[model samples]
Target: MRRPLIGIALVAVMGIVVWQWPGSDAVASAGAPRAAIASQPVANHGNWLATPTADGKLTMVAGGQLVIDAELRRLFDFLLTDSAEKPIRQIKDNARKVLAERLAPGAANVAYTLFERYIAYRDALGNVKPAADATPARLADVVGRRNALRRQFFSEEEANGLFGEEERYDRFTLDRMAIEADVSKSAADKRAALEALENALPPALRQARREPVTHLVEADKAAELRAKGASDEDLFRWRSQEFGAAAASRLGELDREQAAWEARLDRFAAERNRIQADASLSAERKQQAILALQNSQFTTQEQLRLDAALALRARQ
Candidate 1:
């Protein structure tokens, strides 16, 4: 099977996005059954030509409860992409049309109702101000408030189904931060506490958290091997032995891309140093020369990151 070109993002310390929302006690009523055609066609729009990230299945469990999860969120986001550009009424109609096309009538109706409530909740959430402090206490307080607001719109089951995993992960992260920041704890105690926290997580969450760390460790080892004069074939064979042929191929591509990027940066730096060392040029002229050089070397978008890259280079 072909591997994905991009990898899933890994969680980092203080990297979780804080949800800000005001409280609301208005619960959305359950959707009622309505007669619908079996072959309902979606609205003819340019956006629907391609496959969506999520198919908007509106799946239910054996107990006749809706199964809410990240997939549902992805569907909602895909449908609501035009929210900023279009009026709410039109956007909702478009979403309903797509859902009706993809799902059974009863499920589509229920999904539509839930989508509306989600929109209302999100609207209220938009009014909340983000906390300036990134301290664990402040983050936890913000999460608590956001959950309170979420509960007012959804029942216990609904809220849990929709956001349980993310909430759990957030709590775990905050707890980890708190433990790491504790001044009195010895290094050994901190390690034990961190290990305990990791052990407490569900298997899926544990795996998710470990993947990025594993990748970083593997990358460092690969770099060491390369420093010892490992050839491309040697690296490929090593990576393949470790993580299958397909994954090794992808890693090889990544390695080449990184090498090419570094080469470009080196060339840029060499030319830059030469420009700076030219004694005949005035300060203004040198500045203009560097600006011209940057324009010639990088696109407008790439130029945005050039300063930060240069700063990091200087530190190194």
Candidate 2:
């Protein structure tokens, strides 16, 4: 099977992105990446969660078709996933490209070049599994053609690009993470999750590198805003409206809350002054009455306060 010459991108399906408001700096930079993490299948149906509404399965049923070992399904899935992820594929690709600047230089890392070339090949042949006859000879021939048309790892630079120590570490980490995450999953689920992960990896890492820089930029902008005496109220209000709505949209939380009661209390106290200019209320006397009422905690006293407030407000 021939691999894809180009990567898969679903962005063409999503029409006209509406930008956030003009001055709302809360928006991710136009260049900022939206990343897709590996999707976990909670599906109990043999690990298939979402079947294509039309096709009725996430991938073609690999059973009785591939004529390969159980582990071969993942190899097939790696080939099947498009250049673009379900979401973060674009950014992830960019990250890969950025990393490729280092990885592609080394011809010594056959794994990196082999993996990359096979990926293109796999993408090209999509959805169609090899007819149980993809024997060693045929597979070797396909891999050879890929090697010929692809990177020969011919130079020091190409070797460097193909294998960097740091790059190797990242690849190992991702490979282990992918394996660990989907070990319990069925073939389809594992492939789907791994594909989601592989497609997202490159750009996600790039954005990770960009994060501290973006944060620094944001901090500088904030200091400038503060110097200009910009109040946090506006920024907070805008972002609170923009971002927190998702967090706030949750319902059924009322069940978790205890009932609340609002209570008011009032009492009349007599005043007697000996040799004073007039019989008047003192702060000390008021404090004593409030303490007594609070200590009593009487509902009738609360009712009395409410009634008195209503009468007083009515007179006003």
lDDT of 1 by residue, 128-207 (tens): 44444557776676567777878878788777766676678777878888988899999999999999998997776665
Worst 10 residues of 2 by lDDT: 12-21
Candidate 1 C-alpha error for residue 91, in Å:
2.1
lDDT string for model 2 (1-316, tens) is 1111111122200011111111111112233222222111111112011122210111123332211121222332333344354444553454345334433334213333444554554344333222222233332343234333324422434323322322332343335344545548888877776667556655534333333244345446546766888665544443335335322222112212311222221122212112122336476765665556545553665555644654664586
Q: Where is model 1 more than 4 Å wrong at Cα?
A: 1-66, 213-215, 256-316
TM-scores, all candidates, are: 0.65, 0.18
Q: In terms of lDDT, which candidate is strongest?
A: 1
Error of 2 at 102 (Å): 21
lDDT of 1 at 147: 79
